[model samples]
Target: MKKRTVADRGADGSERPRHCADGMPNTTMEVHVMHKSIRTPHADTRRRAAGGELIGSQEANGTHAWRGIRYAQAPTGPLRWRAPQPASAWDGVFHALAHGPMAPQYAGLLAPVPAKLYGRIVGDEDCLSLNIFAPAWASDAVPAGVQRRPVMVWIHGGGNAVGTAASYDAARNYAAHDGMVVVTVNYRLGVLGWFRHPALHEADSGTAEERSGNFGTLDLIAALRWVRDNIAAFGGDPGCVTIFGESAGGQNVLTLLASPLAAGLFQRAIAQSPVAETFSVHEATERNDLPLESQRTSAREVVARLWTAAGKAPDVDAADQALHATPATDLATWLRSLKPEELLSVFKPGSVGICLSPRPVRDGVVLPLDPLPEVFRHGAWNRVPVIIGSNRDEYRTFLADKPEHVRLLFGKLPLLRDRAEYITESNFYSQAWRSLHVEEPADAMLAGGHADVWTYRFDWDEAPAVPFVRPDILLGAAHGMEMAFAFRDTAGELDIFGINTSSNRAGRRAVAQAMGDAWTSFARVGVPRLSGDAQWQRRTHGMAAETLLIDSPAGGGLRMAGVRQDIASLKASLRLSPQVSSGESRCRIYARVFLWSPLFAGLGSEQEYAELGREFGCAQPASVFRQLTEV
Candidate 1:
């Protein structure tokens, strides 16, 4: 290993440490000079590059934490809505002392009555920054190689609108335990990133032609490029990299899979609940109803309307200046000055609102076409192994907020919600009904694979006791619930999954260990394998295969029952039925009966159950149930 000296910057940028890769300077010694007062670039100690700074402890892990490294120049003035440009390199060792500001915030869709109270404050225009957390240079945690440790690039999620990489705390997973270099990045969000214009596309012309949209995704690619070139200095292996995320980040991973620019960047990917959708530039442009100029025209009109409403001359430059100089509080107050309906009419219209006007542009270059079609075609990605699945009650979070609202839609029968709610509530009565029941639709989505999809239901419902909300009563493994388990993380005053009891804790730990192992192992090799003979089976596209359920005990025994067969029959019937879309198919009709039939069977209402099945459109003989016995 090359010897190095490091030092801490003392306010006016002066080095402080004496000499210590090891305390003893003779035997196997190397000194990391904390800071060199000289302010010389390479003359300070070790490797030199562009503007960079050291962080973390050299003595502890030989890892230097480089905070807020700029990947792109500030997208302001003329550069706004234009493609990102590489940041200009600096001469001396510039200080990367603080995290760069996040992208300028916007009042998002449905941004409450009191606007400031609705969402987070907007940040700076120069928000294209990244944070690196790696093992310090002198630590024993460094991977055994001439190259540095592997890198894991994490992209945070906020519906492609409201999240930041800074929100995630890596104290437990990436920074402390994994021992790999972890990079969390920030990019433009909402309109700032996804805005488009015909003039902007025309500006690029034939030579330096650029896509008019998907700038946020391009930012991710830029960050990966930075990692490929510079990670070696921080003892990170550039070759072995894994890109992982959830929600929009998951969507971003799917986007990366389809992006030709991101072709050779990542070795493997894990997409958790990737949303399948199609976005188009034409569709995006239509949202604003821009008269050929897109957002610029829209912005101009909005400024005119706002100024006129405020009884001032509708001066565009003055409005722009006001927007720039005004405090966040003032912006909210100014916005509130207008009537809600008046503001909505001018800025937002019907469902196609201003806030989501120009979303991730589907320009031909950066985003060639609809990504979903490419993914469904399967050849678009490099065919690298992928791990994809959703939580058990994936749709539960969607319904959790409004029980009355949910009842309006789901309570009307010939649906799965009522039955799912019943089965979920059945757990309170006894463990008997809760034993090994699988929801039909979830099973169908898992089984109908175009790739090697590993399915899991995060059933570790160990939440805190709030009034009216019971873990068993409401939110049975809701959407996004698995994120906590996958990261094995906790949030809020209490751990988000307040799994208090020893049994619950043990279950959480076991599931966490299983998931963490699956993730890291998949990153290392292409396939994720379990420790024992407990193989992580690949769910095929056609047949209903077994899924590894991460329940109480880590490697608990498999389900002895035949729930998959029942699900398979239901799926097959739906595809064959003529009444499929009408919500009255035999499959749908039988599904409800299947959930409650066993209950009636015990009460000698077996004949009544059979007659009910006839009413529900079960075309087959119902008496075959009495002939079969449990193994």
Candidate 2:
């Protein structure tokens, strides 16, 4: 037997710590922990890339989970606004048991939940962690001929500002039952994660990928690197990794496709209703509704304004000048020095009409000047088998929001006076329901010889309505509704759709089964097939866009909606819609729903909103026009 020799003890008999392969020092001692969540007798031993061993808990259902594992070091203090660094090595066995802390965010960001059943939570800066779930079939090792399951890395969506790795618990998903592995990740959020300043740019001596700003994106890249290096231990194919995210997470997935820094980290990708908007860094940094360009907001301007308003500085202008003159290193130090609360006050949610958080920058280094155009037109992005889709009723979640603004501008429409109304598929005055969301971007990805781009439209709207004003209108497979069905995550089951008797239980179950299988199958072989044997086809031609409409209400089978037929249907719907004004304005009630899609954009044009207003006959109040002029 080869005897393991350690360095001799010091004069005082203190043992020397062993060094990790990653150069992080650690004590050469193993830890034994019986994770409480482990219901099974057998625990899996997984080794981390940084030389830490993990005792993963086995589920009663024959699955295994390694929760709250830090993919990167705690991004705090000096590391606050910088890219994520490597996680340090630990001497004892790191118990991948409890979920990690989430990035700091405002409360109530989650889909409405039953507080009694699922407790409300806060966040912390020490939150760059991830959770891995593998099927019971995926033991520590597989035979030479046996294939390792594909890894699906989940990035939760809360507008790149909120949400955590622990937000959705899908222990019952296909990944846990089928031959696959799932990983949910947490990255920095809000001002802490995406903030960038001209001053912080001073010390950027590293490569373009090391550029500051968009630290949240950087954290994601870092997590992907960690997964690529370490997911094998969990019985995953490091090479065959797919990143799937919804909403903001979907946007991140698309961004990753465009990011040179994130190249080769992932293979296949799925983006669910990504917030598709790309603008220049200046366009992002500037204020939306403000009058003066000089008063446009950025981290520097906000810090200066907040400091001056708080009486720390002599005045606002002087503070701005001082901040501009501040050294780059000192600028980062000073920004980190300010109270998190104070910094957040500068750009709180709903401060403006929009959720204008610090957007991902188009810094010449990390992100190109224009990503989508370059990718689709110039062909400069990481091409992979991609699935991009959106719900049938996406704007329903924010229906009341836009309508509320309209109500505030022009006195409430008599039709929707009392109701917190939004656009819907209801046949209001012969107008049929239509949606253009998430389709335009999908069309942009139909480049030949690039990737097999499969498009989908989730049209089931049988979700249980919660406290939302109108369950009928607000709960139609709205934005982010598919996540629960995709991961089979029922954490917010009760509050999200009131699972008791309101929701279609059997339908939800069926949809969940189909979607889960589709996702897993896609990860397995880059194609999504339904249980009923209908294949999801790709859109090859520009106008011949074909999508697999994943719907249960219309029928429990795949309904292929070809773009050619869809265009004809849209024209028919528009022709049926009234073009002239009627009593109390029919356009006000239906324009947002039927005319608000890119598919229907040519029909609506830039004058659609005005045309709708004209048809309503109830011209927008003079006050509303005045308000617009003032702005």
Candidate 3:
């Protein structure tokens, strides 16, 4: 196969050449090009780092960006399903212009493509690369008495299934305005990233790390190792590195906290809208038999599906028998021989190309055998300065897409079908998300003796109230809304729905500035100091724990609030809340909170659901609960 170079094409797969407007090779050491006009430049875009000699580009923000720098070799062919290996040093200048291919996944919002390719499988297996954004002075000679800037590594979220580093421009505001070094990484996703079966393990002679069924987690550790070794070349302090991510990325942040291999790799951690859930080795490898186990796609299920599809068996039972009879080595080779698309086809796709697959396995090697909250409670995790938070209306973004709750006007804009139902469901699920992802973890960390833990609740929901769209009700402080504020994304890179309108720009900018300052301040020092008299406090134990409420000035601005509710309290309140009009409605909410949401797996039981229903004088039938359980 031919080698890929940055000059070959753009991320959209269009062929483009790297050159200056003067029709000459743009190989100057330190040339600044502003609005297509060259100007005086003091820093060299070229750097000799641990990876190799490479040439980056000077961005409009006065930040230098090095794109598509390989941190690990391609996890393809024989290297598939194995721990990442470091990339070998190259000989000549590498054109770090465009981003490398993302991990193979169905096209969606996380990895957007043209409409014609919306749900099609895109990207490649050779996708273990990272992008760097540093202040202009980073690549230049160090000043006489200046200290190295703090490093912040960002991990994108796509359910650990579909996301790319290229979608984000780290230099836009974080690296440029905050005076910090930023790095974004791409790792394997979906089944390719996390899968475990006895056959593959029997065929391999590798160590525990390779057989952990947590290849994506290992990829992140590899990226951190690369940062530790090479970040200093970009004038960043490796010792002050911070890892921050949202959603699935946030879950990864929590996973790293529990991972013994990740100890000392980072000094500070931030997990935004993270799910504090990790699967057991049995959950990752076998089919779900118990009611507590999540109905996620498992290794055995995938093999059976593939077997039936290939005419090797007529049904899942037959497929399982055939798979059991086959030799382990032969099974391993057959699995590796399948194409990426063929392997991905076995699982059903969600509304936007999301595949509900198992990931971040608790293999007892990379991660502790206990659950993340339990790990924290036992004081066994990497106890670092941590900042954890969640959006106030996280579930609205997800529920807005469901036809039962919302309907699209002209098949484009969203209109809530039942306002009361929508609000009630959104409130319950959103708070449930916070309980699992934010509150429980914070409380557990405090129990585990980690004192420097700051918590926040993003309450900014100033989206414009345009015609045919009820932004306030539909997407008020929804999941991922806080990301733009954190990154100060004035370019609207994340505003896919046009939420950041002209009318809301001022309020958005204000919130963004506040959030950006707090984030960078946390990265610099352990404490997150806000502007003026408003102080962000660390979370303490019990009900009086303080939480910083992040919002626009019109929405109360940034201030400290008391502790929030947990899952048990939320459940108890729901049973008494006037919003639940009927037993069926209450049962539906219970099913979604306990069964449908992956974060709440093993936290609910059928008996509990039945008991809750009995409180309403009409318990839902067993069939109704069973159908929801399967979902």
* Backbone clashes under 3 angstroms, per model: 25, 2, 0
lDDT of each structure?
0.49, 0.60, 0.79
Candidate 3 lDDT score at position 24: 14
Best by lDDT: 3
Ranked by lDDT, the better of candidates 1 and 2 is 2
Model 1 residue 327 lDDT score: 56
Instruction: In model 3, state the lDDT of residue 496.
Output: 57
- The C-alpha local distance difference test score for the whole of candidate 1 amounts to 0.49
User: Clashing residue pairs in candidate 3, if any?
Assistant: none
TM of each candidate vs. truth: 0.63, 0.77, 0.90
lDDT per residue for candidate 1 within 105-191, as digits (tens), equals 433322212444343345666788887765444434444343455567877655565556655433225434455667778877655
Which candidate model has the greater lDDT, 1 or 3? 3
Off by over 4 Å in 3: 1-43, 138-146, 290-294, 543-545, 622-631
Rank list by TM-score: 3, 2, 1
User: Residue 147 lDDT in model 2?
Assistant: 51
Instruction: Output candidate 3 Cα RMSD.
Output: 9.2
User: Which has the better TM-score: candidate 2, or candidate 3?
Assistant: 3
lDDT over C-alpha atoms for residue 219 of model 1: 81
